[model samples]
Structure formats: structure tokens, C-alpha cells
Target: MNDVKAAVLYAKDDIRVEEMSVPSLEPHEILVKVKATGICGSDLPRVLGDAAHHYPLVLGHEFSGVVEKIGIGVSRVKVGDRVAGVPLKPCFKCHDCASGNFAQCKYYSFIGSRVNGSWAEYVAIPEINALPFDESISFEEAAFVEPSAVALHALQLIQFQGGEHVAILGGGNIGLLTLQWVKILGAREVTVFDIDDERLETARALGADHTINAKNANVDEDWKTITKGKGFAVVLETAGSDVTMRQSFDISANKAKVCFVGTPVRDLTFTPKQFEQLNRKEFTLTGSWMSYSAPFPGNEWELTLHFLKLGRLNFKALIDRTFPLDNINEAFDLYRKPGSVKGKIMMLND
Candidate 1:
């Protein structure tokens, strides 16, 4: 068995680079040489003792790679094909999957969460998890597909009408990516809120019509003024802050849709008045989790690729930093610091 170097999380704030055996491929699996992996905010809980799960696990889910070996019965891709994967593994036979709601499948599993993921030099994955990358897309840019898909999924849940206004409650990667998707879906205006002024500037560059620095300004007054006192048609909460979640109610128009795309910890509480307001105003409240099953109907991986191919997405602007695999601890440290920029920590195999 070949040995591969990986950053494994043993417990809270405990991660180390270690050598492990390369995973064996099943008949339906394919071996991939991971080229790039992006760190996510979700991984912070696992690192900070906030998330409830076992450790000594590989934790990267946003990744892109080249196909190295195809297990028996694999024909969709051959050796040396560039690809990106959707980490979700849904039970295709479930009723939810049959109805195009794979995210609701009873037995859903995801790579890098419940299973080993792409932090290693190589990963053995099922063919279904893999999506072909067009020749025009680079591995670095393709790494954005997973997060972009997630933002796209959130937009789908809201079912926003064309020319409607949207307010996104974060200027992080997901928030910025969602802004791009909202523009693609014909939203009349996209306003983004962030505590960091740098991130707010980044949001503006990424097509946001307006930006709010919550640290220095009042979010409610600013949002009301931006929407001309009617509030926005859609409010997306991606900051995962209890304060942001609470403020979501203040910025939503009557009959507006609110989508919670961020996963806040359990300690955050909501007031009964919020639900009552939702009921009285006929507000639609929904949550979007990870991506699931085939064709990914509403998401924008296809569209993101198109934007990338046409040089419209501007992924370079979003990439704040990159780190070698050996410096992963430094990367995580940077992530924990306040005022970190939007986009990802690219892990390169040296």
C-alpha cells in the first residue's frame, strides 16, 4: 500500500500531518489525485469543540482533482480526466430522491463530514460523486464549485422571482457566491451585510448593489433605506450569527422569503415573536443544507463553469490566500482570526 500524507484532526484544536495508507477502491469507486482543496467555515466547529462528532478525521470537502485509476465498472471517466465532486452520497432509491428532493433523503451521507475527505494526496470516491470538469476550468477555480453549488441551492429554496430584491447577511464566500447567483437569476438588487469593511468592499466588487458594515452602522435602518422602507423580497442569512438571524426578521418584506444557509451553534436562541411575525406577515422561512443527487437542478455549478469559461466570475479576486499541505496548521490559525477575507484557503500538494 502506498503511503499518503494528510492533515488529520484528532480532537479539538488538535491536528497533525501524518502518513496513512492510500484508500483501496471498490468496484464502483475511482482513485483521484487531489490537486486542490478549500477550507470552509463549517470546519471551524469541528476544530473548536463546538460540533458533536468523532475526530482523527480528514476534513476537506471542497476539492478538485485528476482521475488516476478507475475501478471495475467505471466508464464515465478515464485516467487523467480533471473533475470536481459533489461530496453528498444520497440513497437514490429513497422517496425523496425519486421526487427530486435528494437533500431530504432519509439516509444521506457526505464526504469530509461523516466520511474521510480530500485533505489527503489521493481520495477514492464513488463515480457518482464525481462531476466532469470542462477543459476550460482550472483546478483552483473548480474548487469553488462545491461552495457555489451550496449558494445556488439556497437561492433555489427561496424561489425568488425575477427582478425581486435580495439582502444577503454575510460577505463570506457563500454570501458572495449567492450574490452572483442572485444576479444570474435576475434579482433587481443585491445588498450584502458584513462586519468587516474589507469583505463588504469585496462584495461590492462581486456585483452587490449595496453593502452594509454592521459593525459601524445600523443594519435595520440601512436595509430599510436601501429597500425604500418596503424591505427586501428575499433575505438570506449566511453569517450564522445569532444577531444576524435575529435581524433577518427586520429586513424582510411582508410575504418575503427568508433562507437560512448558515449553521449556527445550538446556543443561539430565537424569540417567539419572530415566529409570530413570520406567521402574521406570511413570511416563508426555510433552511438549506448540503448538496445532494444528480443534475442538481437549481444550483449553479453549470452556470458557475459558464461564468468561469467566459471570464465573468472573477474567482481570482475571491482567493484570499493559499497554503502548502505542510502548513495546514497555519492555515487554520489564519481562518480563526477575525477579519479574514472571503474565499478559501487553497491547500496545494507539494
Candidate 2:
């Protein structure tokens, strides 16, 4: 492969579009020509702050591509297949991976973090990580499979049968995606809380029963009334702020399932009230990491494709904007603005 164009992160706040060498394949690998990728909220901190596990990285894993080449013995997908991929490549010798809990593998590596990733013309991934989709799905929608699957996996951790009141504590991408899943899973009522009125409105259009602007409203009193003082049967905290992380426990019901899906901006600890909710209400809190499971790639990816194909999940509506890879700096500035409800800024290959 010749040198390919990429957005490379040389250091914190130092990303530039440059040509880099394309990756070589291993026996189990496939070289994908990246078609589309989405700049994740996590990408901001990692590229602008200190979240990169390593520097000079090509920082994007939420991408869709077409297979250009394959390595020896690779038969999961062939050349020209349109695909979305899981970013993880876990060392199977680890006890956790051997037991089917791939997410907890002792020696796990990631595309954007541990290795170069999809912010380029091409990326090499394991055949298992490259999931093929039919022509019915667009690369834009396929690029979203990773994030959508993340939201789906978080819901998978809960035990909601259906017809339960669930409150999503953030209206970001994950929050909104989880909101759709809650409604699809048959929640009697799904309320979304966010400081962004625009995101709340978006959530409303996407099927949330109600929206609360935490910046202006009293979440405690309103949440009680919203749930008829029964509290929410399930709560998802995707905001990642210190206050919202604490609020996830505060508004939970007795025996409710609470999932923290956001990457915390600071240390998350259980304070008096949060601890009291844990003690008094008997809350079950599940911390969801990158989505994956036994046979690799996980159920989330499978179900996301099914829902996307059936029109149950709308990937296009969640996209607020798009940019060519060259304008990544401008995209980053726009995304960091106060109250910006940028769903997901799609980065396109020129």
C-alpha cells in the first residue's frame, strides 16, 4: 500500500492532516479503505486534552469502510465488502477473554488508543472486527454502528422487561441513542434531562415523553412528579459531569437499575445522598465499557444493524453536521461551544 492521507494527532491539541503509511495485515487481518468516520465526544478530550494512550495516533474508531485486501486465511469477509468494525483486539490468552468476557480482557488493545485507527484513508483490523453489511445500509449509518451498539450494550446490562419508566440523564449522542432503545424496548415513559434545550427538543422528536433542562429546572422535584414519586425504574447517566454522575443515583427508584454510560470528566464517587440511594433504595449500578462479548464483536453490533435496517433507529436524525477531514480543527472548536447539541460531526473522506 502507498502512503495514505490521515488526520494524525502529534500531541495534545496538535492534530494535522498528513500522509502516513498504510498498515500491513496479519494472518487474521483485513485492510479497510475508510469511507466515513464520526468524531466522537471522547475524541475532543483525547486530541485536545490528554486522553490519548499514545501520541502521533490516528484517532477515530467509529468508522465504516470497504475491504481492499485481506491476509492469509482470512475468510470472514472478502474484498469490496462494505463494513463497520469493532475497535478492540483482545489477547485471548487472558483469563477474562478465555471466559467470554472480552471487554474485561487483561491485555486488550484499542484502535484509536493502543494502535493507529480510522482517521485515515485505510486501517487494518481483525476479520472478526470487520462486520459486513449489505448495500441497504449507507456507510454513514454503518459508521454509527459502534456508538449505537455502545448505547444498546448499556441497555443490555439492565433487566427491564418492558413498560417501566426510564429517565435518561443526558441528551448527548449516547443519551439520545439510549433514549430510542428505551422507547423501543417498551418503556412506559422515557424522560430525558439535559442542560441543552436543543438536545432536549431533539430527544422529544426522537420519542422521549418529556425533557428537563437541568440548567433551569429543579430535577429533584420534577423527577418525583414525572415518575409520580415512584422514581424511575431505570436511569442512565451519560453526561459524565460530576453533578450528573451524582444525580444518577439520587433520582433512582427502589431496586432500580442505573447505568453510567458517560466517561466521567472527573473522579466519580458516591457521596452522602448518592450513597444513601445505594443503601436505601437498593440500586444496581452497572458500569458499561466498550461493547464486545464472547464470539467477539458482541450482540450490540448485531442488534444495531437489525434495528437500523428495520428503520426502528434513525441514524441520520442524530447527525447535526458534517465536515471534510481537512476541517477537523474547525469541527473541534464548534463542538466545544457551550450548550452545543452537535449530535455527531461526520468526517468525510475527500
Candidate 3:
């Protein structure tokens, strides 16, 4: 391939579609013809808030495509295989990685940040990063594998078991996906909290036992009634906002497992009262980073595809809108306006 069309980010709020040379593959690499890519919430700051590591980058990680070619030493997948892209590239030699905690590796490179990514017609990825899926799953659905894996990783971090009350403190894409995974994994009751009524409705449709609009309702009182004053056995903080992060601690039951899956943008502080909840309740507080484990990108990626094939993991409603690759700038524009988009915004290439 001589020429490739891509969405190039030149500076903050400055992304354009341009033709660039296709990337060359090295050993253990695969060239995927890009099909569908979801615009992650993290990407907003990279393009609009100047959170990108460098300029003129192709910012995409949640993506799926067909393998156009494979470099030598690539045996897991062949040309024409449908695959999802794993963004994390951890140094296997790091202590964290050697211990099966790839997400904790400090020595690592990331696609879309440290290197070029898949907002283009094609992208060259490591063999282990391209996870092949069955023909039944659409490229759009496969694009959700990264976020789905993220949601699963958080649950796995706490070793969540079924038959306990679970509280999801966000109703965004990741929060909704986490809710679905909670229900699929047999949580006794799943409650989703969000400021948006529409997203709360979506969560209800996705099998959330209860939906709380924290904006209007008294969350402290509502959650008390929902949990029958027992509090949630497991609380997942997915909004990354100051309010929800603190709320996670407040809504937890004694010795509850609380996992922070959302990334916060601003400085966070907790009052002496709020901070004491951890000590008093004996909460197992943990933060989940990128998804990965022993055998590379780990079972989270595979399990996502398995559930997708079984129709247990829903990906359709999570998609709010789809934009053509040529109109990616328009897609980013939607993000500039607050509350303009609800779910995942996908960019598709024909």
C-alpha cells in the first residue's frame, strides 16, 4: 500500500484527514486494514484539551479491522482475519510484566500515544495486539473489545463474585459496559448512577436492577434504600469525577471491594470524614489500569469476544453515532459541545 488516508492531529483541536504513506511492518507485526474505531473519552483531551504526548498523531485504540498482511514471525493470525486492536505495549522484561501484571509495567510504549495508532486506513500492530474474532461479530462490535476488556479487568481486579449488590457510579460508555458485565457475571442487583436520564434509561435496558439519577435524586438516601441500608458489597467508580470517586467510598458496604476504573482529570481531595470510610469500612480500594495479564493482552480480550458471540455482551446501544473516516473532525466537534453525544462515537472506513 503506497498511500493511506488518516485523521491526523496536528495540534489541540486541530485534526484533519490526510493521505500518508502506509506504515511498514516488522517481524511479529500485522498490518490491519482499518474498518471501525471508537473514539474513547481519553481521546477528547488528546485532540481538544492538548493531553496528547506529541503532535501530528493518529489517536485511536478501540478499533477493529481485517488483517491485510502479516510480517514474519506472526503466526497467530493470517491475512483477512477480523481482529480487535490491543493498545498497551508493555516491556515483557519489566518486573511487573514478568509477574503477570502487564498493566503495572513502567517501561512500555502505547499505540496512539507513544506511537502511531489506527485512526487511519491501515495500522501496523504487534502480533499479540491483534485479537482475531469470529465472522459473526461485526467490525463495529469488535471495536468495543478494548472498553469491554477494561470493564472486565476492573471486575477481575476485585475478583468479583456473583450474588452481591453492585453499584456502578457512572452511566457513560464504560459504566454501561461495566453494568452489562456485572449482570452477565451474575451480580445479585446492579445499580447504575449518572446525571443523564437517557443514559440511566439505557442502563436499565441493559439489565441494571436500578438506575439512579444522582443529579436530581438524593444519592445517599436513594442508595441507602436500594441497598436496604446495608450499602453495596462492590462499588465501581467509573465517572472519574470528584463527586463519583468520593461517592464510591460512601456507598460501599463494610469490607467492600471498591475499584477505580475511571481516569480523573483534575486534582481530587477527600475530607477527613470521607477519608475515614476506607479505614472504618475496611474497603479493599484498588485502581485498575490498562487491561493485560499473563499471556499478553489477557483473557479479558478473549472473554469479550466469547460473550459477544454468545450475545451476552451487547455492543449496539453503546454506539451513539457513527461517522465516516473522512469526517472525523466533525466527530470531534461533537465532543467539544458538552452532552452532545451519549455513547461511543465510531469512525468507519469504507
Candidate 4:
């Protein structure tokens, strides 16, 4: 195996770029020379102690690359194809996978989290996981497929029927992307809340009907005032904070469905009053994990790619910065900076 450079996480705030043996490919795998990879919100926690099964792990899953090598029997893609890949590896013979619910598969491994990921110059992935992109699409745009898949997948859980008034908590990238989906999917109006007004403006620019600065204003009062006490028909809790989670319960219309898309860093609590709101509203609460569903990796991945390829889901506005692999440490610092610019930050293979 050749030597490759990768960013490995040793522990909380302890990521280092060092030389490592290149990953070997299985008979059904293809080796990809990563061209671009984007940082993810979940990546932050794992890099800072919200770790997975192991440390000393290469930490990037949202990426696009050119095929470099192929193992024997890999026919799905050949060398030099530009592609984006799914990080979820499902054992296809499993009952869950057979039924097309890869997320429910008993035997599933997540790349970047369970194994090595794309922070390196090269990564070995299953042939099925590698998807060739249109020549018109840049690797930078392809790198966004993963996160955009996540945003779209959350909406699939509710299978939005349109004409619903929506409320999204958290004006992060996922939240912003979700707001666009709501408008496109037929929500009459969408109101987004974020602690940062700057981020809220980003959301509004992306087509949110209204944006709320939750930190400076009373979320309930503002929600009631704008909603005329009717509340939202669909509530998406993407902030993961106890405050946003509880507010999701408070501001939801009766019989509304609330999907919790954010992974909480700490235990969240709800007061008796909050519990009463749930009881009174009778909202359906659901948790949205990673964006894969069935037929192995799921429709979320396909849906994201289809829209991105068609240019319907324009994420160009989401990219704010790019850095080389060597400066990945600086990339993470900016990501963690308070009130950092609201857009995607990427690591180039160069």
C-alpha cells in the first residue's frame, strides 16, 4: 500500500494530519482520491469527545472524489470517474436491507464514524457506495450531497402533503436547507428561529417566510403573534438545545408532527408545563437519524442527488470557505468560532 496523508482524531481537540498506509480495497470496493470534503455539524462533537466506537479515526464523510484504483470484481465504476459516495455500508442480505430500510439494518457500518473516512487523500469504498456525478457538477457541489441528503431525509419522515404552515428551530445549514424544501414541498408559509439573527438572515435569504431571532425575542410570543395563536402544522426541531426542543412542543399546532433532527450534545429536559403542552396538542413526535432509508442506502440519497443534479436544490449559497487538508485544524477552529459565517466550509485534497 502507498502512504497517504489523513487527518486523524486522537481525542477531544486532538486531530493531527500524518502519514498513514493507504486503505486497501476489497474485491467489491473502489479506491477514490478525494477531491473535496466538507465539514459537518456532527463532526464537531466527535472531534471534541462525542466520539464514536473508536478514536484515531479519519473524520470526514461528506466528500466527492475521482476514482484512482479498483479492486477485482468492481464493475460499477472505473478509474477517473468523479463521484460522491454514501458513507452508510449496509449488508444487503440482512432483513432490513432486503426490505429497503437500510437504516434499520442490524448490521450496518458508517464510514468516517465506524471506519476511515474522506479527510485523507484516498479512501476505499464499496462500488455500490460510489456514485458518478454529471460532468457539469463540480466536486465542491458534489461534496454537499451528503448534508443535503440529510436535510431532505428529515422531510421524508413526514412525507409532507403540502399547504402546511411550518416552523423550523435552528437556522443552521440543515435548517436552512429544510426551510427551502418546505417552501418547495408546498408549505403555505415557513417561520424559522435561530439564536443568531445573522443566521436567521441567511435562512430568510433562502426563502423562509419569516425569521425569528429566538435569543432576543420571546419565541412563544413571537410565534403566537405571527401565527395568531394557531401555531405550526409541522415543527422541525433542528437546534438540539433543550430550549428549542421544548419550544417545538410549545409552538406546535394540535395534532402536528414534530421531527427531531438534531443530535443533542447533552440531556434535555422538559418542564411539567412543556409536558402539558404535548398532552394538550397531541403532537406526533419522531426522531430522525441519518438520512438513509431502504433499497440499501435509501431514497434520501437518491432524492438529494436528483434535485442537486437538476439544479433544483441550489446549495451554492451554502458554501462560505475552503481550506486545504493541511489547514483542516484551522477549518475546525472557524467552524467552532462564535458567530462564524453561515455557510459550508470545505477541505480540498490539494
Model 4 lDDT tens row, 205-297: 888888888876476688898889988999998877888898898889999999999888788888788788878988889988777876546
Q: Tens digit of lDDT per residue, candidate 1, span 1-350?
A: 57988888888888889998887899989988899898888887887664626677888888999998999999888898898877877777888888878778789777787778888898888987787877788888898888888888787666666688899998888888888888877999999988888888888888899999887656678878899999888999998888888888878899999999988875776679875778777889899886543565334567666777887676667788988888988987776776564567788764
**143-229: candidate 2 lDDT, tens digit per residue:** 999999888888887756668888899899989999988888898999999988889889999999988889875767888888888
Residue 270 of model 1, lDDT score: 66
**lDDT (Cα, 0-100) at 279 in candidate 3:** 98
Clashing pairs in 4: 100-294, 100-295
Ranking by TM-score: 3, 2, 4, 1
Query: What's the count of clashing pairs in each model shown?
Result: 0, 0, 0, 2
Clashing pairs in 2: none
- Point out where model 3 deviates above 4 Å: none
Indicate whether candidate 1 or candidate 4 has the larger lDDT: 4
Cα displacement (angstroms), candidate 3, residue 9, comes to 0.8
Query: Model 2: how far is 73 from its true place, Å?
Result: 1.2
What's the residue-level lDDT of 329 in candidate 2?
84
State model 2's lDDT. Answer: 0.87
lDDT of 4: 0.85
Q: Model 3, poorest ten-residue lDDT window?
A: 211-220
Worst 10 residues of 4 by lDDT: 293-302
The TM-score between candidate 1 and the true structure equals 0.93
Best model per TM-score? 3
Task: Give Cα distance to truth, residue 271, candidate 1, Å.
Answer: 3.8
